[model samples]
Target: MKIMSVFGTRPEAIKMCPLIKELQSHTEITSVVCITGQHREMLKEVLETFTIKPDYDLNIMKKEQDLFDITLNILDKIKAILIKEKPDLVLVHGDTSTTFSTALACFYLNIPIGHIEAGLRTYNMTSPFPEEFNRQAVGLVANYHFAPTEQAKKTLLAEGKDPKSIFVTGNTAIDALKTTINPNYTHPILEWAGSSRIIMITAHRRENIGQPMEHMFHAIKRIVEEHPDIKCIYPIHMNPKVKTLATTILGENDRIKLIPPMNVIDFHNLLNKSYLILTDSGGIQEEAPSLGKPVLVMRDTTERPEGIEAGTLKLTGTTEEEIYKQFKLLLTDKVAYNQMSHATNPYGDGFASKKIIEALLQNKKD
Candidate 1:
């Protein structure tokens, strides 16, 4: 079986690389990797961490690229590769423009598509910007739906996806944690944090860019000011607007350190050492729970409702007042903090990649 895996961003690479490694181990499968280079530097870090070198790199990223540029460029470039390789199956991960475009190209060529981390839905098109739309659109045409949870499977069933086509493989994000997290890892940033309680922050969602971002920063500023022992380490995103806004509001504080993005290995270890987390990123919601870190999701809604139900995540919407309340509650109330930290991680065990590959092999046999 010729199975080609396609991914673009850092988050997608983190989840997909483990599955790619598993694919390479099987003599029956010819695994091909194609990267869109949508996230450029950040994506490279993850690929390096997993020791994966793509067979084809689209290199479509450009300065200030919009949704139109990403979607159109991927369609234009990947079509030729699909025709040349003509794999038996093309696999795509999550809801980036790369996933949607690759799936569409496979659809045009009549090649079967297997969607990883499938059936996630917020049903709100504008909240996560293009992501919600991208995932739903991919679901419409995917030949196999590898949902990470029972809730995701139910969502697919309700949406009329065929029962036989869906498989409840645990999330590959959990699979990634197995390889990345190191107990002996040390960094200069951890030294700087010292005995202070660490609060790791990652806020770069498109919908939270302007006023909502400012509000988030202000809340963090207030928290750092009130608690002298708490230190915040924000590994800022590559977006210039996010950097400028974050610098303007949360900068100049002694307790808050705004730094560049870290590699997945370092980031996972940091999460392991952190007191708590604050973010709008979806992958982190699943990843943090495994490290026993309580996460406050800075969004109005989330597709990963399993985390919330499992008591590991709190959906504190984008507002200064509400965010401040939740942040304070998590910090000051040890009972609340212990309750969240001790909650079971609902993502998966480390065998998700194995299960995903088995599903593909079984389908081929049938």
Candidate 2:
């Protein structure tokens, strides 16, 4: 059977790359990759790093893009590719607009779609904004749901998704670690961290752009001032709005190195090197725990509650005092640090790609 793997954006590529490699290795499956290049440069870097040459490229990037442009552009461009290739199944990852739009296009063509990292829900639609809506919409149209954890499976079942169609395959993001993070890996960022405890920070969520992001930055700035031994490396996202906000709060801070977004290998390596992580990004919550890196989630709510329950994560919300208190405690208290870092990873054993492909092939036979 022919399976078309579609993805866009950096996080989607990092998570989906492992599954794509697995599909290609399987003798029974014909794996075809198609990139809706919403993130043109970053997507290409990931594809090259994974050595995945796309069967089709829907280069849908524009200089100044809005949500409507991305949705409509992918719809028009991918429809033709789906019609021409006509794969037996379309595999989409996570909750990006690309994943939802691709699934919608496949649904329009009467094709079966499989959703990877499915069934993650915060219940509140407005928290994650478009992501919550996108994933929910895909859940409706998807023929197969590859949930990352038991919690994710429960979520799908609670939403009344068919149990038989849902497979509790662990997250593909964990699988990506096997390919990307190497023992011999070296980078300028890693070198800068030196012998000091590296606190990796990534705060660029849409909901946390203005006051919330400022609150997070201020907390970090205070941490830097108080703890001279600790160093921070923030791989700032590409959004200009986030840049302006970050600049305002963290400008000319020597201890806090704010760099551009790193590629998949670099990112995985940094995550590996870091002592702890602080972020509002959804994917990191799943991926970080597997590396034994405790993630202090800077959000009010999270879809990945399994991590929080398992002690691999802590939700400190967006308030400055809350963030500062939690961060300070983690640094000063060894018990709190060890408890969080040593917790069992609720995500996967880095073999999630194998499980996902096996499920797909088994279904085709059935």
- Per TM-score, the best of the predicted structures is 1
**Candidate 1 lDDT, 1-366, residue by residue in tens:** 999999999999999999999999999999999999999999999999999999999999999999999999999999999999989999999999999999988888899999999989999999798999999999999999999999999999999999999999999999999899989999999999999999999999999999999999999999899999999999999999999999999889988999999999999999999999999999999999999999999999999999999999999999999999999999999999999999999888978899999998998899
Off by over 4 Å in 1: none
lDDT of 2 by residue, 1-366 (tens): 999999989889989998888888878888889999989888888988999999888899988787799999999999988988889999998888899899999999999999999999887787787788899999999999999999899989998999999999888888888888898888877677788899999988788888899999999999989998889988888889998888888877888888888888888888898889999999899888988898999999998999999999999999999999999999999999999999999898888889988888788789
Candidate 2 minimal-lDDT segment of 10 residues: 187-196
| Model 1 alpha-carbon miss at residue 106, Å | 1.0
Report the alpha-carbon TM-score of model 1 versus the true structure.
0.99
Model 2 segments beyond 4 Å from truth? none
Clashes of each: 0, 0
